[model samples]
Target: MTDPLGAARIAIIGGGIVGIALARALTLRGLGEVTVFEKEHRLAAHQTGHNSGVVHAGLYYKPGSLKAELCALGRVAIREFCAEKKLPYREVGKLVVAIDESELPALAEIERRSIANGVPDLRRIDEVAELREIEPHVAGVAAVHSPQTAVVDYAAITEAMAQDVRAGGGSILLGQEVVAMTVEAGRVRVRTAVSEQVFDRVIACAGLQSDVVAKLVGADPSPKILPFRGEYWSLAPERNDLVNGMIYPVPDPRFPFLGVHFTRGVYDDIHVGPNAVPALAREGYRWLAISPKDTWESLTWPGAPSLAKQHWRMGVDEISASLLKTRWFRKARRFVPELRSRDLVAKTAAGVRAQAWGRDGALLDDFAVDQVGPVTLLRNAPSPAATSSMSIADYVIDHFLTVRAD
Candidate 1:
């Protein structure tokens, strides 16, 4: 059955999980004639592909927040989608461990938050023995175990979404970088590097370039995006038995980043230490992969100077860990005492998170979506954005799409 608005032309920028998910949803609903414009040749090339692929169980976010709501719902939705599509979905579970008495308060806070968020099968284990039973190699005085927290191949999911979009008569235009967008009359005119096209509605999910894209569409320039590079190190294949499931640290309440921890991938590969370091470039994976334009924009942002002054100590620590592999291993070794420097030998892929910051240097923690004329800009979607992609698509379509009374 075709929707009444099937004739409407919709354009989505960015080909990450969120963008692809939105495309799939709109096309499947027959809501519009949808087209996805991805700057990269392949989908999920940035944050989507580079993330740890953990389906969040709504632990850290405050109750009633978008992150809490979407993550709680999206995990179940994603599991169902993966099952229907015959994709890899592993419910190996996760343990948020507290190594000492000092971290127990934070762990308890997480437990409280998790319960309020209605996370399934969540339990707070007080005994070290119980923690050991859950994660054999993990050493912690207390732990909050979420049995339903799972992992999946999000890149595969993104590709599957693209396929779904194509099967539903939608087009995915790869390598088409959107330079500018103008709202003329009632339609949005999107100008890409290759060509110019007009869309009934344009949704930009540009990850690293989100702020830039939003500015291009005449949106407010506050809450500028600062790209923070997360560097991961793969555990040695021989030491695969270090942990059975995901082992995350009790995140510092002061900082937005969840500290360096362990994650078991869908393929049974273990990864450690995605320390948050300010990237010199938006797409900077390595220290040398610098972009002058990206650097200049970040350095000059009103929030950057204030942010630096506030979190200089934490920033310095992350930079040191990024430069020295030993420093990174030391951070991880706090939870898993047996995890040696040799275990953190292999360098895995790096991801740049587009974290939004206010003029006062405060980090924006919740989901941000706004409309400017005929265009909708997804300003900030960090960590669990991929986890909540399907739900987000639903939210966007329900709210952002304009009704044409014909």
Candidate 2:
């Protein structure tokens, strides 16, 4: 007879990037016997699959925030990990361009906070000539260069991390969606659609459905997950050279979406977009794709009234930009004069950001995780999360051990 638990002391829910990375971390620490549970047949099916693959350079986050601190650390850690794995990655650099005087102030703030966050060689270049020399196709009144930034296939990184997890004696069960979990006698009992498993500890990283998973483990589901659809438009192959690097617009402080811009991915595709719009479904990618449960919960939640009141104006603007293609492209054309309605050749993909809204209807501005018994729930991890997975995993490990000791 075999020991039924599949050789792991702990179970990692959701084989997304964070969970896969955590599984790898646990194995590397010689704390083996870890199992990854993924509902999807393969890894990187959702958020990791839809990522822009821009390895952020630690700019644009508030000074001393988790996003800022972890990004500075993650850039180095991810780059090194890529190298060790012989994966394709580049420190290709990035630029946040301010189209006019009004946006310059925010650009300046970004620069200051970036420095405060310890990003190296970050500087403002007002000279049009200098800007043209770096990326000839991009046109802006001024630009801020983030020389430390890079791009890679984030899905590949997730896959590599999964590989490392298995190599280190851990296992992953694909197509195993954890339908329910309960704590009994100081252990975790996880019920999947196909099977049931028990572990000494459980860590869930279900991205869009984080709130639902949290509730399944007996944690309060106060910070409701709000889905923001970020749609992208890939430029025609002929138009790629015009957008030479990651050309960004100065983001509006009131909104989390970094405004539609140009990104030159590691695959040599110059993509534009990520217009932030309210997603009708947690996984809605197109118009009319609505999830009744998600829609009802958000509208009826006590916290949503406050959140809507706070960002009602911004939400309206985002929706306008999303529905009106002309309005959205006009934003991209600010930095690239050559951009036209025809420049957008392909609907590359879109991502749904899991924004956490509190019961009072306020947005959660930081990373949040909750644990009950042997089950841990990840609530909110947006933006630099892909960049900060390693550090986040370390923090989770520390918390798990500390709680276990107690």
Candidate 3:
């Protein structure tokens, strides 16, 4: 007789917030066995641990998109999860400031999307006096205040979710890099550098390597993952009082990357930045952190040339900001006049965004997921993904997993 556990074994690749959340959700749904494979020695080592820690209010997504729906519902879910776990969740709010009359149209569009997305306690302030009441030191002709926007430690939340998985008898295998996958005999063989295992089914939330992992399972690779590095500068400790909560610019509607902004963490330390610049490698954090293979993969893609031709100006500006500290600080100073170059003295850890781009050069603007054989792939999940981790998990379980609780 064969082992019954083999019939019920389920594998999840990537040990970030999404994967751990999925593991816990599946275990709670009465799955007999679940295993999480993390290449890193610890979980949340990539995007989960490197983000600005803002719990998005679902204000910037398209009204009816998966990002909009999931982020709204997920924000509430995160609050509840934090409360239950005794984690810190601070409702410090957010202000999207429009510096001049030129930005009003974009700001108005954002407001429309926010309302349609059912964002609660969202208000518009056109008067500088009213804006002063919210962000006293800011300079903007108009602004949208999202009072429900909050912040939390996403890595901590991910760890807590992992605990739930462990408590529920699931296994988390660390430092296991998945190298290949072969689906046959109604089970998928998942291979790592050190070992190989056969699972009844697999779901990959591989983040930065999502495209590569999907390709291993025979998924289409039209939308290649392009790595964009977002580097941050920490505000001087004494200058932390410059901003209350988060202050953002009216983003360029044409692009997916949000402009440089100020964010106050749960620890009350403030950071300015995250300028979008092309990274030399997939996981590149510094300019010198280069990978010849990763660079070749990006440069050789059909979308790379077209995307460069389309947004070369913006790309140049982003690279300029990334290289020149003064240029970056000047952008942040537009909203907060008091912010000086000296205020942004400390360098914070940078994050590489795994942005998906089509062959025609359009940046994919929504959460993208698809199925290939016995594997379900979360191809693109950016920004509010941490806030929407639990919701995405529920979506995958309820829709993608055919082997559900009876």
Lowest lDDT 10-mer window, candidate 1?
397-406
Candidate 1's residue-wise lDDT over 285-354, tens digit each? 8889999998898888888888889889988988898888878888899889998888887687999999
Cα lDDT of model 3 by residue, 1-406, tens digit? 2223333789999999999999998888775589999999999999999988988998888888999999988899999999999999999999999999999999999899999999899999989999999888999999999998999999999999999999999999999999999998768999999989998889999999999999998899867888999899999989887898889999875453568898889989898878888889888889999999989988888888888898899989999988888889888899899988888986788998888888787889988988876788999988889999999998887677754321
Candidate 3 wrongly placed segments (more than 4 Å): 1-7, 254-256, 403-406
lDDT at position 91, candidate 1: 90
Candidate-wise lDDT, in order: 0.87, 0.82, 0.88
Q: For candidate 2, which ten residues in a row score worst on lDDT? A: 1-10
Task: Return the TM-score for each candidate structure.
Answer: 0.97, 0.95, 0.96
> Native-vs-model 1 lDDT?
0.87
Task: Compose the digit string of candidate 2's lDDT tens values, residues 150-266.
Answer: 888888999999988888888899999989888878888889888887788788888888998999976888887999888898898987778777888887654546588788889
Model 3 lowest lDDT segment of ten: 1-10
What pairs collide in candidate 2?
Answer: 8-33, 303-359, 303-361, 307-361
Which RMSD values do the candidates have, in order?
Answer: 2.0, 3.4, 3.0
If both were scored by lDDT, which would come out higher, candidate 2 or candidate 3? 3
Residue 260, candidate 2: alpha-carbon lDDT: 85
